[model samples]
Target: MTRTYRTLDVPVRGGDLRVGVWEDGTPGAPTVVAVHGVTASHLAWQLVAEALPGVRIVAPDLRGRGRSNELSGPAGMAAHADDLAAVFAHLDIPAGLVVGHSMGAFVSLAFAHRHPGLLARLLLVDGGLPLATPPGLSGDELVAAILGPTAERLSMRFPDVAAYLALWRAHPAFAADWTPELEEYLAYDLVPDGGGSLRPATSYRTTLEDTVDLNTGTAVTDALAALGHPTRFLTVPRGLQNEAPGLYSPEHAARLVATYPAVRHERWDDLNHYTVVMSEPGARGVAAVIREELSALG
Candidate 1:
């Protein structure tokens, strides 16, 4: 089924935040606010919204990414969480389900921490729990270590969307999972830079700041400790580059679930970090989880 898509600029602290809303024109439909990864736009949730035909999905381009790239402010888990609060207010979403991917998972946890009353529950995808990082790494080193070429691409300029698409087309993570939806998502990520070139809309500085904070800051840790909502954490077997042992190894994921006790854990052995929501199969799996969670709410 085809869903209607619309964009709205929401008033936020530094500037207007661009929000994407998708729905099937159902009256009084259940609403979910989805959050993308650190360097992603609202378009990242496109497939998931498509899979969820009658549900309304509201996703935002977080500050310093997508159309919200120019918003001035320090980017961190806490700041992103507060921005989410504003999103909930702007839409009058008193209590809503949330789904966060990658760094967005961390932001969702912070949102649950700061604005618990606004959230019904959480669906944290491939993130939310603290990552195991090497000891005593600087911010840049940490970003470089975790994000690798993904972070480095923020500094590079593309001649056009095709060039940018070409980069991901060759990525191991998307090689077998490539789809036109991925192309559309990647194209929306580009904005014009000076000198007739285009760069990714996500700010490298913001990405670095967020990466450091999620890995080192107290916000996520605090949120995990005080987690009061029903949260489900899904893990992928492959990492960002389609490498083995993705974000969390089985033992590590089990350990996190054991530690948190409140968060339910599941693993998708065939999917990787990026494909967990970007591909059709992945989106369908996520949508199934969302449907189950929504049913549970009723």
Candidate 2:
């Protein structure tokens, strides 16, 4: 089924938020608010949108990425959660399902904690559980370790969008699975950096702030402790670079499940952090899980 893709700017406290709405031209379908990863835009969920036909997908370019880059932010999990709530309010969503990927999952947890009555069910893809940091790493080291190339690419400059594509083509994550959707998502990430160059719109500083808070601060921690919404969590064995063990190691994931009994965790060995929602098979798997979770709730 061909989906209608519409871009809109929803007014928030900081300013307007750029959102991507995908649906089958149906007016009253169930809405799923999708929040993207730390440095990613809403387009990251294209495959998921396509896989879930008839579902109204509301994906927002969070505070400092894509077109929302201009919004001056007090950026963090709670802040992004508030921004999502604002989008839901503007769309007249009293209570809805939310699908969050990577850091977006943490934001969703914060959202559920802050706005308890607004979320009926929650899905966390490749993240949201408390991350187990190595003992020796400090702030910058930990951020660099966690994000790797996803963080490094922000400061790099390219002569053209094609050059940026070339770099992404070489990336371990998208090398084999590159699709038109993924290409468009990468293309939308670029903004002019002067000198006939292009750079990612994701603010490095803002990403750093979010990384610190979500990893160590009280907002997400406190929220996780009190998260009462029925939640589904999916994770992969690979990291952003398509390397093994991903964000949550097997041991860490085990600890997480033991700690948060409400979060139903599942693992897909074939997918990575980026591929879990962006790629075809991964999206279909997630969409099925979402459908099953929703159906079970009824």
Best-performing candidate as measured by lDDT: 1
- Model 2 C-alpha lDDT per residue in residues 46-114, reported as the tens digit of each score: 998888887888999999999999897589988898999899888887586888999999999999999
- What CA root-mean-square deviation does each model show from the true structure? 1.0, 1.3
Q: Please, what is the whole-model Cα lDDT of each candidate in the order they appear?
A: 0.91, 0.89
Q: Write the per-residue lDDT of candidate 1 for residues 144-176, one digit (tens) a residue.
A: 888888998998999988899889888999989
What is the number of residue pairs that collide in model 1?
A: 0
What ranges in model 1 sit over 4 Å off? Answer: none
- C-alpha RMSD of candidate 1: 1.0
List candidate 2 stretches off by more than 4 Å.
none
TM-score of every candidate relative to the true structure: 0.98, 0.97
Candidate 1 residue-wise lDDT at 179: 87
Can you list the residue pairs that collide in candidate 1? none
